[model samples]
Target chain A: MTLTINDFADLRSAEALEAALRAIGAERYHSNHPFHHLLHSGQLDKGQVQAWALNRWYYQSRIPMKDAAFMSRVVDPDLRREWSQRVVDHDGTREGVGGVTKWLRLCTGLGLDEAYVRSEQGILPATKFAVEAYVHYVRERSLLQAVASSLTELFSPTIIKDRVAGMLKHYDFVDEATLGYFQARITQAPRDSDFALAFVKQHARNEEERQQVCEALLFKCDVLWAQLDALHHAYVLEGGIPPGAFEPVREQGRVAA
Target chain B: MTLTINDFADLRSAEALEAALRAIGAERYHSNHPFHHLLHSGQLDKGQVQAWALNRWYYQSRIPMKDAAFMSRVVDPDLRREWSQRVVDHDGTREGVGGVTKWLRLCTGLGLDEAYVRSEQGILPATKFAVEAYVHYVRERSLLQAVASSLTELFSPTIIKDRVAGMLKHYDFVDEATLGYFQARITQAPRDSDFALAFVKQHARNEEERQQVCEALLFKCDVLWAQLDALHHAYVLEGGIPPGAFEPVREQGRVAA
Candidate 1:
């Protein structure tokens, strides 16, 4: 459903505005993409799965930079303090402990080497484009849009659950340790999304501002959907390996076909 | 093909520097993507073609804005005077004439309404993300990289040649008039890319700056490739349409058994 800001122009309560934005996600999020269907069902081949993880690391790595850009712009100390945790959440205290470390572990479990993955020398051009776009969005657009894009965290928990459950049940090679990232994320995503959603709702004052918030969430969804699309196109359909993406193995029984 | 530039080193000559930058485009440009093969070959369905034109319009439309941004930063009168014509080339003196208008005409030829195409309300999130990334890359990155990204136009004339030739040969519906955009682009791109290349070569004096120019071109390749990935995903492979991308009409024979 296409929503015009006018629909919520007269809204006085935050609850109604929140409901409308949530409904946008309920209907439009990446969880609804068929590629996700393949992912959650374990219908994707190992290469496809690897592509997902490798491409995702780009997204994972950029969070802190983009969030820092956002935090740097915030004048309010209390809000900056609250938002700073997001940077810590992704970067972690030491080496292999935080969200980025977990994401790297996920890539490692997929058989990607630490140095190569860190180099980002193996990711698809499309993945880089989409991920960088997210970083740029956070940096350039209004603070409200930055916060709103983070609202995709609103729908991510459900996806994480489905992904964890499906991979565990359908793929024998997958195990809890390899999936440590989601364990943290299952809790972390909600906390992050909740903070973001509340921030957006509270801060987005006029109808125009509210619409920008919605558009930001939609843009985040596209950032994600575009990633999957690149993976599917390069690995699943034409099988055209872009110049730098992960190389799919030559297993005969591979299911991506 | 990876370049390492850790310190500031001066260049030997503009010719050698221009060669290095062009080499970057040769290796990284998105004309090499498989999706472009389908696009120019007319292998894509009507919807896929429509999605391409529509998504690309976002990039085309932004040419002037990016040029304007670059112009805003330039301190030299001669440089700004030469650069400002890019804005005129894109936005034009009056409506229905400039590069943007010609692009919209191409979109109209592909079956999109002028208002719908112009609203850009329906462009894939990835397209907006990539294009916005380009604009911001110009805004924030080293001025050298900003100039370097436009170096894709260095390779664009070849892509334009192949695209026009292939489209004319493969599609019954496409004609030269509808592709006036490319015809103009043929001359304009070479001239533009040439100027940008010379500017970068002369300005980017050291190895570190040279490497940034190369990486900038790679970043730009990602931008173009990502746009195609979004279109391929939304309109072709996954068959899932985002809320507002082009809606494909299913042909009777095109349905899978």
Candidate 2:
């Protein structure tokens, strides 16, 4: 919990680097955010949950694009082959069978229109910015940093588990079919993270490089955390939604703990 | 005040296109945002103002880069020559006197550490995302749409005047010297917007193109509006700052209006 840039003062062992990356998740991942807390505890109503899901769909949809940006910069066939799995996973081998589709299903399961969500016309500007920043980071940063950023996947399985369980138990609107996206992620995240973490630990050969690795994770965490922050401010807190963002039809959606 | 995508049903006269663009500004500009209201009225304390100036420094700093992105894709020498002036204005003819440097001076004037501000280590992720999105918008969109987005400058003179006048009047820590950046922008923004507007008016050759122009401006409006939304949420409202964002040392900064 007390890791810092100074802690990576020397070239760390592979085990040490992995631990540092995990420590980052322990401290900064979106699972620790209030919106997720509300979400997993069933403290949020369907409309509030809908806002989170709708905004989140932007992040989900951008994953493949982000991966593609990363892959385009890479010259190694091995890395490209491994990285392309992510794009295929979300986009799927066939239509209506991928991570993006499942998330869309969750949105519709919450009563949002499919076209509106697909159009992304209602997404918060902050969401677009945050997700696009992730894509750009992958596109533009060092290959080590770009791969290090995906280490968020290391922590995703648990968050997905908590989210699926919480939503199913708390919201009448949520069901297994609707929540399949997270279910799929439980397996998918660990697989992706393993690849990324191994690549990072091996590729990041110096203390300075290790520091960048930590910063990359921290930035990625901020990307995920900020998306939820936008949602929490817009939907959970008194901060009004930004104009042109999604406005839920129903007002009273939170269930008191 | 009521306008919709339907309003661009015909590619009206150039005068009509100008009216609709102005109407978009009337209805959607950041001048209508509450954060500006707070800023213009001196309702924020030095710390809140610091957060605004510091975070806004990201937007201010990105202008030259955005212009350069816009200029990069211009195939016409006339357009490129005209557009490159924006870069010169922000970057200045010589070292240390451009719009970007002035904004940096404002941050230093606000009691934030010059190096820390320059590092952008403490900036809200939302600010980075929003500003970078603007730069990307310029880089990737149609040249006409990219120019149309700059039309937020169309409304900047009034906001800058109100801000300069109000901050000088209300905040003890502020002086005309620190606020000189806004004074410079008053001339700069209008001149840039006029050129952008004329380009949009002439180049948008049909109803669909005009509609795209309107949508681009709306997107630009959302970009400006969303930056304020993040500031208000993080600094003004109860929404806590994201991990690693600039946190003002003194919390009680908002002045009673």
Candidate 3:
């Protein structure tokens, strides 16, 4: 059945809400985007893949910030305690260990400059906009919706698996080590998404609240899908790269010493 | 001269800063984008034009919100009063008027449903993110930088002129009435942009602040360029329409009832 906002106006049981939220993922998640199809099937060249990794670093780096925004408004110590782990997962207890660092390694492995990737100077303007929208959403929305937005993580493990397998099999630049961030996230996303899903199911008691939860999840999916759309557009289609975004350096043969 | 953050960090005169800002527009504004070139040259078919108008409505509709967000943070009565006119220009003093309503007229003139346009359901996801990013930028950044971002208006009159003349000259579906918004903006943007420009000049006194003012203008240009990039990618180049964005209905031959 096609889902509409009106359809969720009547109270839904927790199970029903959960199912609706998952249905949104099944229908709208970034995994379904054509760019991902190209990415997984080795259709994109190294420069194109580097563009994806560089732009995505903007999103990955902001996870801690999004989580921090959520945690600042959250009052419950137990909820805060559980939620703080997401920050740690992304940022790590120390430098060079967390998701962001691993992502940087992936970029460097693909021959991108570490400083350029970190500066976010070369990312597509769309990537910056969509990722920042997520942070602002967490900062400004109701705490329940903030938590609900994180539900995209519920669909991540499968994408991670497919990505890691596909990248390892198809691309020689990427190996298991370069894909460490996904390996870490395969476990972390589920743990975080589980808590968030439970929190949303528990807190979204009324129909209006449930609808908000569903909308939040769908919004998160849009954020993810928009990024890939940008990648495909710039790197794959007409090569209409906006001024000042990353231009991958195609390595020429080394000079004989 | 190549514009760099460091170039402005040395504290240029107001004339130099203004020139740099104008240079950025010459190089980077959406007016310079190939899609706009196609649009003004009337290379895009009616369906393609509909997609442009429909997606652009999201940006036009949010102008008041972005202005309001900027105004809410301004403590000065004079500044707030001057900036408030932007909201008025877009939203108008009454219903069935203003820039947004005029934009809808253009959409309807192209045969799109008004409610569907207003609902923003057909807008590219990238458009929503980029436009909302503008709103959030105004809300979160320093008031001077917020004002600087509006300096794109300095470049608007020429674009508006070209767009109107080109559309009226080349397309039968478009007439002066359908282009009311550009006609209105041709006068309004310069007036609003002049006030903003003066405010930015007066407020951005130091080297770092000048750099920020320039950077803010560049960022705003990116916001505009990215929207057109998305349109060209989705409708023009690869036909990789994201699942739920506007799909224009082709008018087939009349059928016997």
**Candidate-wise lDDT, in order:** 0.78, 0.84, 0.84
Please list, in the order the candidates appear, how each scores on TM-score for chain B only.
Answer: 0.89, 0.94, 0.94
Screening candidate 3 with a backbone cut-off below 3 angstroms (N, C-alpha, C), the clashing residue pairs are: none
Worst 10 residues of 2 chain A by lDDT: A248-257
lDDT digits (tens) for residues A1-257 of candidate 2: 33445555555677777777877889889899888998899899777888888888998899888899999999999999999999999999999799999889998888888877887877888899899989999988999999998988898888888888888888888889888888778888889988888898888887788889998999899899889888988888877877666778732121111
For candidate 1 chain A, which ten residues in a row score worst on lDDT?
A248-257
The residue pairs found clashing in candidate 1 are B9-B206
Q: Chain A vs. true chain A, TM-score per candidate?
A: 0.90, 0.93, 0.94
DockQ of 3: 0.54
Better of 1 and 2 by TM-score: 2
Q: In model 2, which regions exceed 4 Å deviation?
A: A1-11, A250-257, B1-7, B250-257
* Candidate 2 whole-model C-alpha lDDT, 0 to 1: 0.84
Give the C-alpha miss distance for residue A210 in model 2, angstroms: 1.8
DockQ for each model: 0.39, 0.51, 0.54
Predicted candidate 1 versus true structure: per-residue lDDT over B171-240, tens digit per residue: 8778898899988888888888889887887887776677788778877877887777677667766546
Docking class of 1: acceptable
Tens-place lDDT digits, model 1, residues A1-257? 54433354544556766887887788668898777889889898777887788888998898889889998888999989999888888888887689899889988787766776787767887677788888877877888888898898888888998999999998776788889989988888888888988887889887677777877877787788777777777777764665545676732122223
| CA displacement after TM-score superposition, residue B131 of candidate 2 (Å) | 0.8
